[model samples]
Target: MNEEQLFKQISLVRQATLKQLESVTEAQADEQPEGFRNTIRWNIGHIYVVQNSLLAKFGGKPVATPSRYIELFAPGTKPADWEGDIPSLDELKQELEEQPLKLKEVLSGQLDDEAAQPFLSLPTVGEILNFTIYHEGVHTGTVKALKDKAAK
Candidate 1:
């Protein structure tokens, strides 16, 4: 896809993900229902962290996310193992809300550039950004399921 289209998709997908959390409470954000490994909060933070990290790592953009987010939400980290202060749901939402614009600002005109190192054979920055859209959708679905279960 072209850079404009790709960034638009990123924004739209993020909006859908945020829409899923419209009714989620702070308590619900932290709830790890049975059969789930992480909470809604973790999924949201992961989405933010992964997108920014990929853009920085593969797109030659500066890292816009805080280091603490990597420690809290990077792959293999889960709510069950979390320690220290975590961002509130609102804070995460703000980050989520702002991320796409930040991505566009940083990555515009650079989408076709080759990755510093290929990831999953996604050799171009644009391809990796495309992957993040799918990744975020998966986590957004998880957030939906977790929210439903937590409401019970």
Candidate 2:
């Protein structure tokens, strides 16, 4: 897809993710239900971190996430091992709300540029950005499931 279309998708997907967390409290976001390795909070933070990382790595944009976000939410890290000051649900939601605009600002017109390296055989910055939509959807689903489980 083109740059405008991709940014639209990013905004829509992020809106859905933010909507999914509308009712989640800070405490609920922290709950790790059975069979789940991470909490809703972790999933949200992961979504933000992964999107920024992929965009920076493959799209040639600078990383927009805080260094500590990588420590808490990057792949292979889980809530059980979390330490230090975790961002509140509100803080994460704010980040999620603002990320799309930042992405569009930085990545506009650069989608067709070559990736730093191929990822999953995807060779362009836009293609990698597209992959992040799928990644966010998976984590958003996880957040929904966690929210449901937490409600029970």
Candidate 3:
């Protein structure tokens, strides 16, 4: 598939993720149900962080992450260990909602362009972006499962 299609898929997945998070409260977002290592909030923040980080890494744009977002949400960071203020679910939703558009804007006409470095055998911006689609879907599924457990 091409860049436009990838962007559309990204938007669709993001919208679905937002819908899943629609009625979740801050308390609910913070909940880590049995068998889960991270909370819903952590998953959401992770989605935001990973996407922006990929674009910045492959697209060569500056990361626009909020202060400490990387520290809080990057790989291996966990909510159980956090000791500071975190972005509200509303803030996370806003960033997640806007990111696809921002990516489209920054990456227009550049999707097929090669990345500076290959990511796990994936070359090209589009390749990494396609991997991100799968990545987000996995996290989205995790969020759904977490939401279900949290509701119980």
Candidate 4:
């Protein structure tokens, strides 16, 4: 699929993911349910961070994510290891809501451009963006599962 179609799917997935967070309270978000490695809040932040890191950092585009977000949620980091001042679920939701629009702005007309350094096997910007979307969906599913388990 092309960039427009891929972005549309990204927006849809993001909306659904945010909808899933609407009922989750701050306390619920912080819960690391049994068998889970991270909290709902961590997953939410990770979702935001990973896409920006992959496309903006790896793809060499400008995406204005706070540096702290990457520090807190990047792959090896966890809520258990976070030191202080974690973003609330509402704050994360607002960023999540705006992410796709920002992404579209930065990446407009550049989908065919090749990545500066290919991530995994994704060689072009479009391919990396597609992989990023898939990554988001995976985390979104984990968010749903964690939210459900946390609510119990």
Cα RMSD, each candidate: 1.0, 0.9, 1.2, 1.0
lDDT of 4 by residue, 1-152 (tens): 87789899989989988889989999888888779898889888999999888887668777777999999999988888889788978899999999999999989999898888889978888888888778888888998898777657
Candidate 2, residues 10-66, lDDT tens digits: the string is 899999999999888888998888899899999999999999998787667775779
Poorly placed runs, candidate 3 (over 4 Å):
none
Candidate 2 lDDT at 1 equals 72
lDDT, candidate 1, 50-109, per-residue tens: 988987876666757799999999999998888999999999999999888988887888
Highest TM-score model number? 2
lDDT of 3: 0.85
Across 69-141, the per-residue lDDT of candidate 3 in tens digits comes to: 9989988999989987889999999989888898888788888888877787778887887788888898999
Which residue segments of model 2 deviate by more than 4 Å?
none
Which pairs clash in model 4? Answer: none
Candidate 4 runs further than 4 Å off: none
The alpha-carbon deviation from the true structure for residue 108 of candidate 1, after best TM-score superposition, in angstroms, is 0.4
Q: Candidate 1: list runs displaced more than 4 Å.
A: none
Kindly report which residue pairs in candidate 1 clash with one another: none
User: Which residue pairs of candidate 2 clash?
Assistant: none
Worst 10 residues of 3 by lDDT: 58-67
